[model samples]
Structures are given as C-alpha cells and as structure tokens.
Target: MSSENQELRKVGLKVTLPRVKILNLLDQSDERHMSAEDVYKALLEAGEEVGLATVYRVLTQFEQAGLVERHNFDGGHSVFELDSGEHHDHMVCTETGQVFEFHNDEIESLQKKVADELGFELTGHNLVLYGKPKVN
Candidate 1:
C-alpha cells in the first residue's frame, strides 16, 4: 500500500481516489498553504477532472481527520496545509497574501513568561504577523 493509503487508514479515513490525489497534491506542491480554488486550478492544470466542490469537501474531510490544518488569514482568505506535527507561527504578507512559517525560541519564552506573569499556564497559542515587503 502507498504512504497516502497508510496515512488515510491511520486517520480513520477510507482511501479514495480524490483523497489520494488531493493528498499527493498537497504533499508535492511548493506552496504549503493553498485555498480550495488554488487546489482546483492546480488539479485542472494537471488534467485532473476533480470538481471544485469535491476539492472543498475533500479538504474539509482532511481537516476533520487531522491530516491538514486550515488557517484563516486576513481579507477573508483561508488556506490549508498538511499538519506536519510541529508547532510554528505564521507570517502573512499583506501585499502578496503569502504565508510563511517560523519558530523563535525567544518569542516562545517571552510568551511563556507573559502567561506566567498573568497567572495562566499557556495551553495553546496561535500567532500571526502581517506585513508587506519593504522596498529596499
């Protein structure tokens, strides 16, 4: 069995063509985060006949199954990326709508310290920064 099949089975999702194709697309794409329209366009470019609604359905299913994560950025934009099982914050470019993932130990420590000072144990956090590219 393929790795995609194994992953689906592990996630308690029955393996199907659309699911496998979508999973492969997500894994192979250069852009980590993609909207359903982006996925549909890519599928069309690849000569796949998957419908937009089907892409949305499959992406939602993947999100529910913990196979992917959905991030809603500013301007009503939403994107999905494979859940790589790592904790990372995001930076979105306001001009390009691009997403960047990063982790900073100092930032993490500061957050923890702030939470501690507030008399709260930080259980979870989602941090997103937005800015446009600066002209040199």
Candidate 2:
C-alpha cells in the first residue's frame, strides 16, 4: 500500500480513489483552506473525476482523522484546511472574504493574565478578527 493509503487506513478510513484525490488536492493547496465547492472545482480543473459529494465526504473523513480542521466563521459556509500543527488565529477581510493568519506574544500574555485573574486556567482559544479595508 502507498503511504497515503497507509495513512487513510491508520485513520480508519477506507482507501478510495476519490478520497486520495481530495487528499492530494488539500495537500497541494496554497492556503491549505477550501470549501467543498472550491475543492470540487479544483478536482474538475485537474481532470480528476471526483464529484462534489465525494469531496465533502472525503473532507469529513479527513477532519475526523485529525488530518484537517473545519471552521465556520462569520456566517460563511464551513471551510476545511489541513492541520499544520501550529497555533495561530485568523483575520478575515469582510469586503473581499480573504483570510490572514497571525500570532502575537503580547496578546497571548494578556489572555493568560486575564484567565488567571478570572480564576480559570486557559487551555485553548480561538480568536478571529474581521474588518474591511480602509478606503483611501
């Protein structure tokens, strides 16, 4: 079995052609985040015969396997991204629907301080900032 197939087996997912295609597409994405529709379009553009439903199914499996993360942000449909094993937050552009990831030490320190004062130990958090660009 190929390494990719082995990974699917390890995650308790049955290895299939459509699943492999979706996994490869997710692996090759520039931003590593895509909606099901976007992934379907990508597969069509690449001449892969995978359907939209297959893309969604494969993404769901990948999410369950800890190979990907799904987020529903700002009333938009859910987005899927490969798990990169790093901690960060997202900033969304309201005007253009773009996303940027960033991290700051000062913000992290402040969060810890606030949690400490509240008598709670912080285990995890998600912070997303949304705004439109300033008109010049």
Candidate 3:
C-alpha cells in the first residue's frame, strides 16, 4: 500500500480519491501553509476534478484526523499545513503576507512558567508574531 493510503488507514479514514489527492498535495507542496482556495486553484491547474467545497471538506477532515493543522493567522482566512510532529511558532509578514516558522526553547520555557504561575496547565498554545520587514 502507498504511504498516503497507510496514513488514511491509520487515521480510520477511508482512502477516497479526494482525501488522498489533498493529502499528497499538502505533503508535496513547497509552501507549507495553504488556504482552501489555494488548494482548489492548484487542483484545477493540475486538471484534477475537484470542487472548492470538496477541498474544504477534505481539509476539515484532515484537521480532525490530526493529519493537518489549521491556523487563522489573519483572523480572516484559515491556512492548513501538514502536522509534522515537531512544535513551532509562526511569524507573519504583514506587508507581504508571508509566513515563517520558528522554534525557541526560551519562549517555550517562558510560556510554561507563565502558565504555571497562573495555576493553569499549558495543554496547548499557539504564538503568532506579526511584523513588517525592514528596508535598508
């Protein structure tokens, strides 16, 4: 069986064409973050017979299956990325709308400390920093 099929089976999801295509697209995409519209466009460009609604549905299913992560970076649209198991934060460029991933032990520790001080367990958290690039 192909890896994609195995992944679908592992998640208890039936290996449908849409699910496998969407999963492969996300996994092979050079851009880590992609919105539903972006995925739809790519599918159309590749001559795949997929609807935008189907793309959205597949993405939502992937998110529920823990195969992908969704982020509402701009508070307007949500982008999806494959969940690679490693934890990382995001930095968004306001001017260009580009997203970058970063990992920092200090920041992680600080978050844990803050949560401990507040007497709340840090089950999960998302940190997104927005900024514009400086022009020299």
Model 1 CA deviation exceeding 4 Å by range: none
**TM value for model 1:** 0.95
Query: In each prediction, how many residue pairs overlap at the backbone (N, C-alpha, C within less than 3 A)?
Result: 0, 0, 0
The local distance difference test score of each candidate is: 0.95, 0.85, 0.95
| Model 1 C-alpha lDDT versus the unseen true structure | 0.95
Q: Write the per-residue lDDT of candidate 2 for residues 1-136, one digit (tens) a residue.
A: 7767887888898888998888778887886668899899988999889877778888888998998899888866999888878978898898777888899999999999999999999998888899998899
| lDDT, candidate 3, 38-107, per-residue tens | 9999989889999999999999999999999999998589999999999999999998889999999999
- Could you tell me every candidate's TM-score relative to the true structure? 0.95, 0.89, 0.97
Higher-ranked by TM-score: 1 or 3: 3
Evaluated against the true structure, the overall lDDT of model 2 is 0.85
Q: Candidate 3, 17: how far from true, in Å? A: 0.8
Off by over 4 Å in 2: 1-3
Model 3: worst 10 consecutive residues (lDDT sum): 19-28
lDDT of 1 by residue, 110-130 (tens): 999999999999998999999
Top TM-score hit: 3
